[model samples]
Target: MIRHIIAAIATLLALWAMVFMYQLDQKAERFRQIQEIIEKSKQEVPVQKTTQPIQQIEESSVEEQMKKEEDEVAKKLKALRERAGSAMAFKVSPLYKQKCSSCHGVNGEGAIGPSLIGKSEADLYKALTDFKSGVRKNYVMYGLLAKMSDADLKALSEEIATFEEKLKAAAE
Candidate 1:
């Protein structure tokens, strides 16, 4: 009976050893495959010597394209500024100068406020009335127009409506 038990234990130990060796061999094979992939990726593929000149030409062309784009953008900005009237050369009423120019700009080209240059007299008058009556919600405009009479509002609107003409005349 004792001899039988010892043989059984030895057989079980041998089986466990065999399983551990097989697992270790599988892990080593996986490690080898990963190392081969890394080596392959790190190897540099050589470029043809003739392609170097072509690459330089392409790079210079790209730089030239960028410079042309920048020049076009600058020209467009200059034209836009000229069209918008860069200088406030026209005279304005004292009432408008005092009350409107602070936020609307000297030539009504807009500063903190929206541009008032292209609006019609009627539109300007309506907007002024709306602001004064609290139909529109700008606190600054409401406060400014609140104490003004209808005549003053109308005069301001008419003057503002002519801002585009004034700018054009000044530019000429």
Candidate 2:
């Protein structure tokens, strides 16, 4: 009975060893195949050809294109500035200068008030109107802007919008 038990244990150990060796061989074969593929790919050389120069546009055509672009840009800028000026001069600038400038500064750059220079006309108008109507409650500005006429408000808005343009043109 002792001899039979010893034989059985030996047989099991041999089987496990065979299985482990087979798995290692399989992994080695896979690695070898990968290396071969890499070596073969590296040996191949790509063909190179002389590239043709890109065609250039005629001088006149180029000039015309540039002119067209300039005109389009100018038109777009003018339209944008006009709209901005109209809104500033009409709705917000005067009110801001009168009521808020002592605090915010003349251009909304902020002194005692927050900067108004870049604030949109619509935003300024809405805030002022809200304050006047009690939709917004600022103790100081509310009372001040409330007394301003609609026409005055509009002119202020327009003026604020155009002020930057005037400054830029002057600088140039």
Q: Which numbered prediction scores highest in TM-score against the true structure?
A: 1
Clashing pairs in 1: none
lDDT of 1 by residue, 45-136 (tens): 34333458888787677767877976886676556445434433577787876667656766687765788989999999999999999898
Off by over 4 Å in 2: 1-97, 166-172
**Per-model C-alpha lDDT, please?**
0.70, 0.52
Clashes of each: 0, 23
Superposition error at 62 for model 1 (Å): 42
What's the TM-score of each model vs. the native? 0.50, 0.38
Q: For residues 101-144, what per-residue lDDT tens digits would candidate 2 score against the true structure? A: 44543344454445556556777666667767769755455445
Off by over 4 Å in 1: 1-87
